[model samples]
Target: MDKYTGKRLDGRYEIHELIGSGGMALVYRAYDEIDDRTVAIKILKDEFLGNEEFIRRFKNESKAIAVLSHPNIVKVYDVSFGDRIQYIVEEYIDGITLKEYLDQQKEVKWKEAIHFTIQILRALQHAHEKGIVHRDIKPQNIMLLQDGTIKVTDFGIARFSRSETRTMTDKAIGSVHYIAPEQARGDLTDEKADIYSVGVMLYEMITGQLPFEADSAVSVAIMQLQADPKPPKEINPNIPDGLEEITLKAMQKNPVQRYQSAAEMLRDIEEFRRNPSIRFQYKYFIDEKPTKYIDAINTVKGTEQPVYNDNYEYEEEPVRNPKKKKKSTASLVITGIAAAFLIVAVGFGLAALLHSCSSGPQDVPLPNFVGHNYDDVKNNPAYKNFKFITETKNDSSQKAGTILGQNPKAGTVVKSNSDVTLTINAGGKMVTIPDLTNKTQDEAVSNLQQLNLTYDVLPVEDANVTKGYVQNTDPPAGTQVAEGSKVSVYVSTGSGGEKVAVPAIIDETLDAAKKDIAAAGLTVGKITTKDDTGKPKDTVIETTPLPGVQVAKGSSVSIVVSSGNKSEKSIDIFVHLPKNVTHDINLKAYLGNELQTEKTVNPSYNDVCQLTFTGTSGKKQLTIQLDGNKYQVYTLDFDAGTFKQDESYPYTENSSASESVSGPITPAD
Candidate 1:
């Protein structure tokens, strides 16, 4: 039996059984006797009671969860740090860990992953706002209920930002597989580290594998430091590009580059949910002149350096022929007079040109062309003198070829024949839908995405096509459809047979029950047995989702069987006479102090005796007397049907035999 089972603590909580165990504590399913409610009590291990580090971690978990009250976070109800033992009472969660759930699923669908991740982010967002950083955020610490609710647990290494002192040791904590790069390096950690861990978990959820893995923890940690994982899309092509970008952004090696907070990441997830095909254009700046090392060089003296004259000009001056002679002053005067006459004539010609420019065409006010048809505007007599420059763009909100925007105001004045730039809405592009019949879900999604189209999967029961394969698409294949439109892909759900009623197997034998269940298209699941006097042993007492209830084909039916009544029990006892006894002696026996039988035994003939006893449902006391002296006292627990000798006299001088002999002792019988 466990040490804590059936034990009561502080006269209020009664521990039932050990539910889980960890390195520092043992969790028990305990009932609060005072409040009449069940809770999980995490008791510090006896071996670690004196170890300060273990004690601190145990207390840290209690403190961390005590402050958090989110729907997705586990709740702590009470804490006790006694002299002999310490424990924390928390809400009992009846579910498996997320890690186990993921293992069973192998690969989670992107939509399901997003659902779980959104809940987790909401929890983290609350925690981050409260200044708590859950240093460990792996799937193992997440609990998944049957209804798909998530509960984040195990805050053993959590830290509070408001606290001045470090609650955890300097050594690297948390699982190395999902720890952030800074955490692996034992660097200062903040909320962003938790985001990194969440990103790793999301990657694993969608890709069915961890971002980094190796034979040893050290190798994995090293990979966390230096290696860049392949994007989730490469592993699972069905993952949306926007989701992949969000995941990778959160997993950035530099904390400064990752999502600044969980709320930011949640916003991106919301955007992805609203428009699955939406892609975020994220950009990061890279320093072109990154620091580098250079070779050492010898020093130069000031005189060794090249010098240039400040007054020197590098341009060459036009040179004159040395043989040429200068002209006379009178000839120079005549040339100057002709130059003056040419200047006067050029001034009069420039005045005539200015007078002609002043008589140009008049300006006109440009009309609004944003919503007007391009053809109408081009043929309008009022705008015949103006030029129109059109650019086309795909805008789903507006009609095809409609002018969306214009550069200048409608009332702005411009010269005739001036350019008027306009942006036209070209609407959605049309593309021929490829044949998607019999294609795998991933392959179909990839093909649709390549054509700038989105898809919705509708799973149908198909007896011919395989599961996860496309049976056919809506609008059929080879049909022309607008780009960015949603296509319905009919996915096969395998051959799900007709639903059948569950047959009643109560009071039937195990083999018979199994046959009946199989005949009803169901299999046995989690058979359990209990003591029941109403039914024979190995007979089915009851079943889960009771008989006659309709269930899908191949569903499992759990059953409980009878292990017989608890009252029917019997035991045999054997005894030997003492060697010192020389004469014939009378032996008497009593059960529960009531006379049973009396007999005489001769030592020379036989020295051993055998007896049988049967009873109802409680412990029975057996007493034997030899020659009127008490020989042995035994206890027989009729409930379990086991016997043990309490004490033996071994033939003493005192004798007190009082019962009448029922028969003469036969030879050793």
Candidate 2:
């Protein structure tokens, strides 16, 4: 057994076992006694205790996740930094690593890959907006839940945008296969590096292989810097062209050519999802300068060829004709006399034209009219030269008659009396609200966004409508309202059952508490009695799931009643046997200091067995031993109705009978 296993830290977290180990830290599944929940504690390794760099990275992970709060990102709960021991407590995710899942599945569909990529990008977008760059992103660092949820984890090497300092070992510290070109080259990196990593993961998912792989890490790093990956469609013929383009663009060698941000990449993916056949106008190789076309129809062997240039003007080269006769002396004198007469006539025309232009209206710069009343500006004597074109819009946020916008904009030089259009606010505009009944949350949100309105989602219990679908909208739908008004969307929690908050029933009589529970739409469950010195017999104590916790209507609410005398309570627990138990195995259940039940069960008959225990009324320790190895534990509040099982270790078929299991474990109701 590890040293930290079975130990309590700060008298609060009871560490069960080491779940994972990284280069600088070890993760343990621990129970938070104070919060009454399980959390994963990441403690710095003893070997790196003296290393300041590892310590810094460990602390940085906490700081990075502290500011980030997203559904697709792992959440941090608490941090403890002591001289000898430093650890961060985070949300315990009951899932397997993405790397493990991929290894097991071998091949993933392109659509499924896209679904995963979209979630990862959403998480990165949230982090990037907060100025945090997740420098290390890979399948190994991602957690995959059974419900197809993705959680990005492991920010030990993340960088903040505020800091530009580089560490000593910065080159390819993240996996070389997924690092961006700039990252592989040890160049300064930002959120784009994370995007590049995501692209690599997506490529791997669709192709079932890495884009660039070599015998050594150094060779792979070189490929990341200088090599171009084959298009995903080439490897997987089923991949869509739009998705392949999006992947390659995100994995571009040059940061400028890559998707600038996660949100930008998400938009492209969303478009692809909407229309699979749609192709984006993303040309990878295009001339920066305009192409020049050669002039045709101008080919002379001896003389310079007359040609049309870029400006589209025709120029003719001079050709000498020595053999031609020259009778120009007499003709030149006549031409000069005619030219002088033409110049005199043109001079008179120019003088007349100049005299006409000097009398026209002069040009003046337009003035700004925004934030001012249109009626005042139009009637002012100083603004009498220009013509006012009025356009009104309903804007409840702006004052009535105030100019909301202008056409010519402030400084455009226009002739006097030119038309200037001014848009004025007419107090408020009325828009007919669209019916959002029975629509999904996303559909309703999209409709509201298109109407230039905002919305708030409120989940309510509706027995008729399906969960996550809209039940109704505030202001009821189809009512005329302002364009920018906020609509309240009441979404259905579920059908046939509605959620209700558990009422506080402590200190009430058992009979009265049962009435309250029934009034709250909850059913009274198994009643257990506890020995109490202060409270009267049959007095109400506490209930399961505590107070204020939201539970479904008609759900069981177990009650613990107080008894003045010492009373014995019995509990029935279901035990699931491990798959490795091929032969007959010994299973024992304990209550407090004594063993309650011992049974020999064969695996072929039933994998699960029911264990019954009887103990004196009070809080007692409950342990399950399989083949003489402690496999599970629970705190039996003989007083609190049914037994409360501690989820410190969940059971799985692949788990060894001697070892506690992790990952997905569906509990019995």
Candidate 3:
């Protein structure tokens, strides 16, 4: 009956004050005499104490979570039933619940959204691994610590709420706008259900809005079954693409389609966190109109207008002729008197109103409310009327609750009772970033996931961090990246990791050259040749990285072979010269400034002649004479000593020189 302050309960805890009261219990900030520390003690509400089922569930969950040792989960210290009452002692938290934070912020930035998501994910991951699913995962159950860390409370309370001993009906259990679809349907719940709730929280955090809504709770539940909400990007375009995909995937209707495991989803998002660009492509569908409502509205009977009663002032006045001017002098005199009285009455009323307006509270200077904690303002009697604009930021410049900057500058003049709006800084402040290089793509992603970062993946070549490892990342690390930023990672798929062989290019013609390369899983780059070889130009003579040698992707392989010049080798090639091949129409031939040592020719073409020789000056030459004509000559020119029809002329070994050129060639005139 009295205020709860410093009154010992059951000789173990001294209740300092009643901190809060809810539907099922009264919470007090108490000192545990045994431990000599401040602890939060929640005594079951009077209504619940009488129900055995409620007491049993309360005892079970209290013991269950009290033993839980997760960093993200709230820890219960003790659970006891004494003096015909059940109470649970828990570690006192100094920060506000996530619901309080979300209530303060209608819309959170992508960075904040991701940061919150990751924290929730970590907590969920732990719970899922432990075989405990937080059936009711919503903002109200999440808490935001001063250090920018998150804590999840009420891990197993939903199951407790299922018992008949609960005060409120299950119908009113979950906070509006956050209950998952299956929970509403009373279906079996698992980890996927918790994930769905988290997705809803994420959607709300980023957009300051909900994806689905309805006039009644039932309709909202039904909407969840059939309607897919728009992606966060549609709500707030600033939301990172990867984060949006992560959110949508978590909220998928089919449990199987949803995350298979909390860790798996976390890993994927973490992978995305490494390269935020690898986004999930969403396929959205419009809702089909319900036929039941449409049919009812269409089939409704029509109504007709009712007739007015004759006696209901329906008669119209007869029109007066304009020419019939006014004649009543006494009426005019009365009208003047009435008008004068009205003026006097209005003048006095105006004077009274002015007199009242001139006597209001003096303009008092506003106090310095910036940087002051919310509780300080919320508790003050004088400043109780002082409007509070609470903001949470992840800033290294100031403490979590400390204010960074304020509006209306402190000490400004204002009406004494008027509520002044204060603009406090959200602590998690940040900016651009630095390079994330020399890290594995997985490692980079894990960091980003923890940092609530988003990035894209671009395949890049690198000697470090092998394939699938990060080559480098854009927005460079430590560059003050804003929360929810897209950080792109160039992962080294290490040149796709496999090598295609270099095809045989020595004897192939230009056309066959490319085909062979293709067959070997390789492609041609640039083709070069040496003239004076008497072979077709553009023909693949030899390949760099050389044939049969393995090379990395995109490596250039130049095909160096022979030019079109003919002398030491030719096929169906004719030559013109002076009529009398007079004595030594002396000539010299060379292949790209080199003597052709091994050359060949076909004896079938008697008109053709070929030779591989060294000149008198120690220079190599190859010249041919056909029917008294100097067919051709190279830099290592040879004298037209004799005109020979046969003898299987000189040429290069295994030469495809006799082959004609083909394949997408640019013809020469």
After TM-score superposition, the amount by which residue 428's alpha carbon in candidate 1 deviates from its true location, in angstroms, is 85
* Candidate 3 TM-score over all chains jointly: 0.41
Candidate achieving higher TM-score, 1 or 2: 1
Compared with the true structure, model 2 gives a TM-score of 0.43
lDDT, candidate 2, 1-669, per-residue tens: 346778899999999756666777889889999999999999997756765556778898999999999999999999988999999999998766778767755357677799899999999999999999998899999987755789999998887876645431222457778888776645567899999999999999999999999876666766776677988878987676678889899998888999999999999999777555445758776446443211122223346443211111111222323574543566888978987997688655754564464548889999999999776676454677787888878878886678999989999999886889999886687777789988999999999998877676666556678888898887887887666667877777664354676676777898889899998899998899878434798887656755545577788888888877755666666666666557776666766557677777766679877676676566777877665556677766555323545643533333254334222122346
Model 1 residue 168 CA deviation (Å) reads 7.3
| 263-353 per-residue lDDT for model 1 (tens digits) | 9999999977755545676776555543221101111333433221111111122232367455456787787987689768865565456
Looking at model 2, report the run of 10 residues with the lowest lDDT sum. 307-316
State the lDDT of candidate 3 residue by residue for 161-260, as single tens digits: 2322222212323544665555554445566777888888888888888888777555565567657788677777656566777888888876767776
Please give the lDDT score for candidate 1: 0.75
TM-score of each prediction: 0.45, 0.43, 0.41
Q: Evaluate residue 464 in candidate 1 and report its C-alpha lDDT on the 0 to 100 scale.
A: 79
- Say which prediction, candidate 2 or candidate 3, comes out ahead on lDDT: 2
